[model samples]
Target: MEEQRAPGQWWRYGPPWSRYGPPWRGGPDEAEPQHGNRRPWRSTALLTAFVLIGSNFAAHDQPHRVPLDPYARVLLLITSLLLLWRHRYPVPVAFGTATLTLGYLAAGYPYGPVFLVVAVACYSAVVAGHRRAAWASMGLLWTGHALVALWLYRWLPPAGDTRAGLTQEIVIATWVLAIVALSELARVRREQWARERADRAQAARRRADEERLRIARELHDVLAHSISVINVQAGMGLALLDSDPEQARAALTTIKAASKEALGEVRQVLDTLRASGAAPRTPAPGLDRLPELVEQAAAAGLTVEVEGEQPPLPPGADLAAFRIVQEALTNVVRHSGSRHARVVFAHDGDALRLRIDDDGPATGADAGGSGNGLAGMRERAAALGGTIEAGPRPDGGFRVLAVLPSRLKEDQ
Candidate 1:
């Protein structure tokens, strides 16, 4: 059977209403409000005192009404005390206070700060999102008062009280409507603040994920290229050690230089991991470092032939282009049987184009090379609205072509 919602219960939301069927309980989520439950003692005490004293003054001013007696004072105190648990039991308290307020009216006690307790209870209920309950309780009080003042006053205490005026009833209704409007406004502002805080948290997580991916790609490219060069030099050093000691010494020197450069670049990358906000010790490498790439490829026994003028690119595009070239050359050194490779740069309208190719008969994982390096290359280019295309040529060779926007940073 579907569980039925309580009459005047709030819409299902927050922690309180979730288990109660429908979004219909008025409990203020999981934890009680800071100002509530923790210390209702002080405020309720003050409210009780005010109602008692203010009703005394009102009795003196309205001598036609019943005098302030022990019963009337205790009745007002009980009405205020209901608010002590208003946060946990908003519906019950709303009804409790409003009903007691009507009883005080039936006794013909002079109105004073006695109504303040009713207002506070209704306020708490409406803010807790039990709007229907608050309205029902308040309606009960007003309707009961109208009955006594208009028809039943002839039989009640303190004789000769005239029938209540319609204007007076209208005035009371206007104030209640105003309080409900203000409560509705407060609820909307609270929900909006919660949504904004959630959005900011999600955005923070997205940026963190992007930063990690960038660091991973940097480490992959740096280690792959440097290790390939070191491996080649180590092999040559071992082969020539006895027969050609001088050539072996040259190979060792090349190995030392390559290791030192790799260490510096690795240190640069680690610095960011250690101290996130610190400025990098060295600026990022760009297309201007093509000579270093050629040298590294040469150390690995591959000859790189260059052609065409390289166009200037945005900082992001520049770094991506340099990494693409570096990864392509590293792949050639590792998997291509060809000792010769060609790099060509071209200008196409507002874009800078790069093409790297090697003459290849066949080598497993050559050019198409597992797509890890290729995927990294594609990610970099796509971040700046660029593209990377790499594959084995139809005639029998490998090719990597990239087209990047020259003014991407300015446009962004």
Candidate 2:
């Protein structure tokens, strides 16, 4: 059987309401407005206190009955208006209410609303983040009660004992103090939770933005290199046609091979992307494919020399190393006027080191293109807890060097 919800308790929405929910209505957990004209509870408390005090004028009075003549009645009404401002100005409101009640007691008015006004003002001070003000308010109220106790003990019909009245006043003051302290504690905790939730939401948004950027970078890597190779090979084939038939045929075949290979590579990358729900595939190209990258640079009319000892690498290290060499060689082919370039890879026990130098302009290559080539290389190295540097060499050339830590752990 379905459990029925109470009609009065049922809201059109629930906890963590959707962003597209009722446009004006806010979630239940949202923070209350701190500096408002008035809280509903504060207003209601004032109304209740006013009604209670006004009714006392006609009630069967004991000793404390300040005549309900015009002056006394008007003073009571003014005190009621002051009660409404308790939340906005707690200390002042508490003083006003306590003073009026003390005068009423001394003038033999009924004690119908002393405790109600005092408690509401004390609670207001706590909610306003003014613990000190709450203590002061309570202290002032307690002093007033003490004065009233002394007055009742000294004179009046049905005289009270001073000792008993003092004890009762002390006990009531203690209760008020406890209530104020607890309310302040609750308000602090609520503010803390609100701050923590905001921090968590900001962190989540940052992570989502980072993930989107990673996807874009991966897509660029997949498409750019393949498109560049196809363009280079097609251009080579067209130039060799007619003048050198045999060489032209070889160039055409190379173009066909390069096109087919590019198509296959692009398909593999796309498949991996689509397989986000499935088990991930083996990564397509990394440091192990440096030889192929060098060969591609050679085909693009630059002579590349590979040197040093390359070792077994971690996944992150492999990707970083691949990107460094790829970007360096791409720069050589695009900007280096020198025909000769060298790539050196070294394993230094705790780290992997890579260096790519080309006889480009000694003053350094033009800072153009998407610039993501070198930027991508640096990002890859940084992601792997590594570092990279690229600049003009002392000799008439350009060089890029990178170091990937053996552990390949990111600082993040």
Candidate 3:
């Protein structure tokens, strides 16, 4: 039996941490909540940036007496402004902020707040799919820090505190850089895993659709002919009851046989649909069963003729050929408006060919354009990587030919 799966639940098989596996795009519930979450987070980031800028201003208030460097404050203001657009344009924002940080370092300004901005910018770069930019920016930021340490050594030489030496500052700055680099690496892994999970989810959905289509085709092939026969037999039996008692009895018996066949096929279809453990019935009608198929169509009042030497075929080629014949014959019964049809299955070395020709009027009041039967035959042939041609024969008949690969038939 087929496994029971809930609709839209196929993504559950992907990695557990994959938040993107769920169908969030254009989903009503997720859209509003995602918007709400982003708005608040953006507001908080803006508040943090302003608060930091405010703190920097408060500390540097005694500007006139000390003659604070206006250029240094301007660079700091630019870095603060870059933070506002970091989430929206992370790579460009990181570049702008890093440029300002380098300028501040060159101007011999303190590295405290500008360093925080650089670290936040790195986070945004990783989240925004700018991993290479994030790494390059990290290297640049570290170089700037080393320059800062050198400037500090030259201007405010280390006092009694031995920890303020070149090696110590380099080591501390390297550790901070490593922390940022590692965080970006983790973010990249998370993004890759999320993408993989989403792909697997989509694949699962496609598989489900294929399975449903296969079941539909099988059910169509298995039950359609038998049910049609039953319908014909029941009507014939009802009409011939009093006048032709023996013929009526024969019609009733035909209905019983057709109904019994339908019941068995329907059970197989239902078993396939349910999740219960049921193996499919072995050996569905295929090319090997073509003789029996022709005989049955003959019994249905169509004169079928077998043609060309038989050829060995792979399972799918065999099955597709059989179905092409079955569907063709069924079409003959439904639309041909004539009693005679011919079925030909020929095997070439590399390919198997099936052709059904019926000596029926192609156009008239009784002959509507060949309906679903022709369409179904074409679909079956195409599914097997084969080609089918169906149209009016030159000699006032309808004909179909399907050429299928012998070896690659079942591969599809």
Candidate 4:
């Protein structure tokens, strides 16, 4: 029975790329939080310029704050440069930017876009799966700023500065909340992209595996049946080559026809692999070709007698039914001592019943029996939500009975 996928697990089993495999894009997995060797030079430079020029304008309005000296400008440069390593060392950059911004405030520098650097670093950290680190860094920076604004004003530069107001504190707290919320949003988005990619990769693998198994079943049925006939006819031709040339010629003709038909079917299967997403040149073999199967069995010295009227079936069930019958007769020819076989068909409501039996005391011929014949038949039946029972009958014969749904599940 096919296992059902659990809820929330999307098994796309996607398109033609299923032939080879998915195009796997490699990068840092969960074990490593780093973005792997990304160069943040351009963005770092832009942030540095924004902070420096923006701080000069901000310093104009803050009458009690210190002016932008060479040391203050140097500190701002260092803070922005730290952002370049955010993708490679997100935790360090997050903490380092927060610490530097806190120091800049303590030194009485004007409040401007310095927090922008901290925000970028923390955002990178959170998106890299280091949420705790980013939260801690932002928390510490906010705490230190609160301390300086409420109590540490006396010890700071640009003297005569008074303590900040309660309203200002509320505004600062809200600003910090907004920054953290934005970072969390970005982190969630990144995680979602990763999950979707993983889903696609899994889908590709499953589709490829299914396609391989299906092709294997087709090739097995085609080659096994045709090769069994060729083996028998070749043996006969060899024995009659000198004694009777006309009979030998007839055997060779059967061999030639059987091999040509087999090659055409094999090529049809191969074409699916060579050119995916194209329609097949020839329709797949089904019960419409049952006469050919019976004739081939006759050429191989086995007589197949049909007992019931063929029933109408959907495409999938029809193909499976043909392969099952073909494999059963092939087995009879290769392994059974009896030259006579009976194929009976009956319809039981929505299901079609197939029974193939050979009147035999077992030949036990191990030669050329791949041992996968019964297994293949069983798989074909099970695929269409059906059952197969193939075992030695109590009455000294081999019986293979298959119950297949007339309509496939997909068709319904």
Each prediction's whole-model lDDT (CA)? 0.84, 0.67, 0.66, 0.88
Error of 3 at 328 (Å): 0.9
Candidate 3 residue lDDT tens string, 89-170? 7888777777777766555444345666777777778777787787677777667656655554354322321223678667
Off by over 4 Å in 4: 1-36, 366-369, 408-412
> Looking at model 4, which ten-residue stretch has the lowest summed lDDT?
13-22
Best by lDDT: 4
Per-residue lDDT of model 4, residues 1-412, tens digit only: 7446665433232222322232562422422333355445567878899999999999999867899899999999999989877987999999999999999999998999999999999999999989999999999998998999999988887698889899988887888888889999998988899999999999999999878888989999999999889998999999999999999999999999999999999999999888889988889889999999999999999999998989889898999999999999998988999999999999898899999999887887755667888888888889889999999999888999999998656647
Q: Give RMSD (Å) of candidate 4 vs. truth.
A: 10.9
Question: 20-123, model 1: which lDDT tens digit per residue?
Answer: 32345554364344433443655787788888888888889999899988998889888888887787798999999999999998999897887888888888
| Residue pairs with backbone atoms closer than 3 Å in model 3 (clashes) | 1-278
Per-candidate TM-scores read 0.79, 0.65, 0.60, 0.87
lDDT of 2: 0.67
Q: lDDT value for candidate 3?
A: 0.66
TM-score: which is higher, 3 or 4? 4
Model number with the top TM-score: 4
Rank ordering of all candidates by lDDT, starting from the highest = 4, 1, 2, 3
